[model samples]
Target: MIGQRRHFQVAHRPRNDDESILPLINIVFLLLIFFMVAGQLSAVDPFEVEPVESAVDGQPGPDEFMVIVGTEGRLAVNQDETDLEGMARLVAEHLQRHGDAARVRVKADGRAEAVEVVGILERLREAGVERIDLLTVPET
Candidate 1:
């Protein structure tokens, strides 16, 4: 009887070429940092000019005009400062140009006096402005 010998070959795993992932990860991190550094945050509207509150919340129509009153009695129409008489004229012109449907929104500083706000409101009334709104920030 002859003795039989058998040999078996084991296959080794192929080497991975995945070292490129490290550079890709580094590039991704760098791009993430660049975007974060380049991104800009919009400036917040001044808190000193806190607006008056309203019971109703909804989108304003296009005919609406914004009037801002500061604590120092400064008056602004659509963010542009104007005198009392000028404001009246401006409001009148706007109403005349935009028609009777025009609305007015008053944003007054929290510390502003009632008289100042009332004066502006009166002027607006005289200008034929019917729909008036007092702007305010919701309590957080």
Candidate 2:
């Protein structure tokens, strides 16, 4: 037996992970793109301004306009901090551009005084806005 020659054969399978890993990476990239695109488009105001709560809810139009009034009565339009005069100008321009189709919404801080809010409303009225909508959070 020692003198006789013996032949031994061994079969090996190579690891094949490229196929599975490729699909996994592709899915990850797709999810990353989806999240990047779907992130919130609304811009946050510079100062904290909690909106007043409202029981009535109305759907705003597509070309909706929003004006932010801070707790200190500072005005911000389109996320651009400005004076009350600038806010009025912007609102008037938006209304002129979109005509009656434009819906203007005022987001005022809950701590804001009624007089300040009324003043803003009066300015909107002066801007030729027939009716202005006040934005509020619904009680949950």
Candidate 3:
């Protein structure tokens, strides 16, 4: 048989481009989803408001309501921009909704006036916010 006219043929299957790249595509999609979900974990401020420096570092609770105050007197509650009265109204509404268990945190720009910040705290107090925590960056 070897010396005679015996033909040996190897069967080869065509490669599918899509099948070769399936794992890569899956990994890309997984990475995309991971970043999308991770990006929304933290609340973003509406404007530029650098936190003041503090001697201690602290982490905010997930359920805490955030109030951002910019250097130009801009105010935002939970990333929604509002005026002082509007902020006060929102705080009151939040207090009514969450009652005494509501947690409030204020993140103010380092350059913001102390009087303005104090006034905001006073307004919050009037709005029935019993405890307010000020967010700050730890000194390096």
Best by TM-score: 3
Each prediction's RMSD to truth: 8.3, 7.5, 5.0
Q: lDDT tens string, model 2, 1-140?
A: 98999998878678788866998999999999988887755556777898888887765543468788887777888777899889878987888798877667888899999899889989888888876789888866
Instruction: Summing lDDT over every window of 10 consecutive residues in candidate 1, give the lowest-scoring window.
Output: 39-48
User: Could you tell me every candidate's TM-score relative to the true structure?
Assistant: 0.61, 0.78, 0.80
Q: Write the per-residue lDDT of candidate 3 for residues 1-140, one digit (tens) a residue.
A: 66789778999889888899999999999999999999999876789888999999899877779898888788999888999888988888888899988779999999999999999988888788988999999998
Q: Give one digit per residue, the lDDT tens place, for model 1 in 1-140.
A: 26977778889778677875889999999999988886643322333487766566655444457787888888777657777888888888888877867778887887899998998888888779988888776654
Q: What lDDT would each prediction earn against the true structure?
A: 0.76, 0.81, 0.89
Q: For candidate 1, give the lDDT.
A: 0.76
Off by over 4 Å in 2: 1-13, 59-62
lDDT of 2 at 99: 88
Stretches of model 3 off by over 4 angstroms after superposition: 1-19
